[model samples]
Target: MKASVTDKLKILADAAKYDVSCASSGSKRNNKNKGLGNATGMGICHSYTEDGRCVSLLKILLTNHCIYDCAYCVSRKSNDIKRVAFTVEEVVDLTINFYRRNYIEGLFLSSGIFKNADYTNERLIRIAKKLRNEHNFNGYIHLKIIPGASPEVMREAGVYADRLSVNLEIPSERSLQKIAPEKDHKSVYTPMNWLKEQIAENREDSRKFRKTPMFAPGGQSTQMVVGATPETDHHILNLSASLYKEQLLKRVYYSGYIPISEDERLPALKQAPLIRENRLYQADWLYRFYGFEVNEIIDETQPNLDLEIDPKLGYALRHLDQFPVDVNRAPYEMILRVPGIGVKTAQLIVKSRKYGRVRYEDIKKMGAAMNRAKYFIEISGRPLPAASAVPERIRHEIIYPAKKAQLTLF
Candidate 1:
């Protein structure tokens, strides 16, 4: 039986919730010629998760009728589920109408492979074109570039999409083969490389000529499914570091694998590995912004992250010899390694110290978490906690202060 658009919307929208890379930042497409919407660099906001991720986009799959029977995927061909797809015009109408009502700030379109790579990719491109040309939508549009598609079709896709992404899915190629036999790493990397070249070339041309069109102005990003396979956190972080360095990817999202159906190849998790996924993101942040290396976060000895403590706190606890840092004299980089001091707070401390000696009160007012920072930092005339200052004691105190206090009373 044929399903109505509302029925298709319910199924497709629910399916799209698994993708966590729909953040609408880093793109600034201003509306011209009195267009409908615009994507500002600040961000688009309609809904948010508990973690504060933006969910303003009309994120949905173009179709769920995939040819491949990936063991991890819900929409795989072998699954007993209703199948439906939207016509090209139907998608355009939804975007236009939804934007007018302020229900969505943009569109995030991905699809399960329908027939072949090119055939599926072309339909995605047509929908984006009609929105831009016919309806004049200048808002953000992020497209999932289909792997194994021709370079010509992908290049045209880059011209219209504000951002492009290709999900690596599994951390290792061997794991990918075991799970999704029909896909490979090469098929994914091929389109990514082409987009990188195009985006770079377009930038050069735009600088030389004022009217050069932007190509994926928000740049390219990729996502990896965590906990689906046996890859450790160390392996995952190393792969992510390489992608940021080699491919020049803007973001690498970590999606905790959700068990759809029981497959021998998959793990038997009661729920998604949400906590581990969050820890990886924190570790990734330390690598990208906090000037830490992958080895510093977790090495071959301790492959997985400490499920209880964050990666930053874990580092601080491991290297207690480097603590008792004097914020007044320490360099900005050293201050950043502190457990409670964030990037902003560290910068403020550096700037404020140059004017005068930054006391304990000053740092507290600057928003440094005194509960954690007080133990690690040495402020003038303010002594650190003399009791339980060792690594084991500090870890226990920070993680369980109430228990530590009860013992101290004895």
Candidate 2:
């Protein structure tokens, strides 16, 4: 007996949960000239806007019938699971109906390799083309480019999709071979390199010719599974940095490996490494926004992040000599390195301090996390009492404030 569309949606959507690279920012497609929808500055998968507007996406997999038996994946071919696929028309109908009803702002579509990479990729491209040309749907579309897919099909995908991604499931080539032997670095990088060039060329062409179509206007992103392999956080972060620098990747998502299968080859984790995943995100943010290098966050001695504290805080604690940054006089870059001072707050401090010295109360008003920042910042040329500058004491106070206060009073 064949399943209905609703049943297929249920199965595939649930199967798609493991994929966490569905953000839809950085695209600016308008519903001009009477299109079905707009994707201007919108985010996907329930991501929020600046004013707290939550945008939702109909995130789903086209199918879960993969051909490869990756040891870490729930949809490995050897696993006995219910298999289903959505016809291209079914997906198109669903997107149009969902858009009319305002159920979703956009679509995020990925798929398990059904037969071969090119075959599966062609089907995905057809769906996007139908949505764009046939229906004039201008909504955000994020498509996952299948590894080993032909460059011709990938170029067609780039023409219609707002964003594209290829998941590097394992962090390193060695681990990738151990878990997913069928895949290799070349298969992944070849498509990624092609997409990067196409995106760049399309931008140049669009500037010269107004009628030129955009290629992955929101840029490309990739995901790496954390804790599944023996790769340290240092290794993962360095890889992320290289992707951002070399491939010009927009984002690198880190999914803490969830133990879905009971394979002896995989780790027997009680739960996903959610904390480490979050810490990596923090470290990544520092790299992208907070002007941090990969080595600065984690080094030879400390390859793993402190799961208890954030990377920024850990960095500040390790380099206490750079602390007590003069909020009234320090450079913008130095102020941004403060553990509790965010980019916005640091900018505000720089702007506000031009007229006069910034006070502790002013720092609080600017939204710096004073609890953490107090020990690291100076106000009115008065640093935190010299006793508080001690790294051990500050760490104790930050980690266990109540205990420290009790000890101080006694």
- TM-score winner: 1
- Estimate the Cα RMSD of every predicted model relative to the unseen true structure: 1.7, 2.6
Off by over 4 Å in 1: 49-53, 381-383, 386-389
202-298 in candidate 2: lDDT tens per residue?
8899999999978899999999999998999999999999999999999999988998989887889999898899899999999999899999899
Candidate 2 TM-score versus the reference: 0.95
Candidate 1 pairs with clashing backbones: none
Give the TM-scores of the predictions, in the order they appear: 0.96, 0.95
Alpha carbon lDDT of residue 27, candidate 1?
87
lDDT of 1 by residue, 109-167 (tens): 99989889889998999899889988889988999887888898888888889999988
Model 1's TM-score against the true structure: 0.96
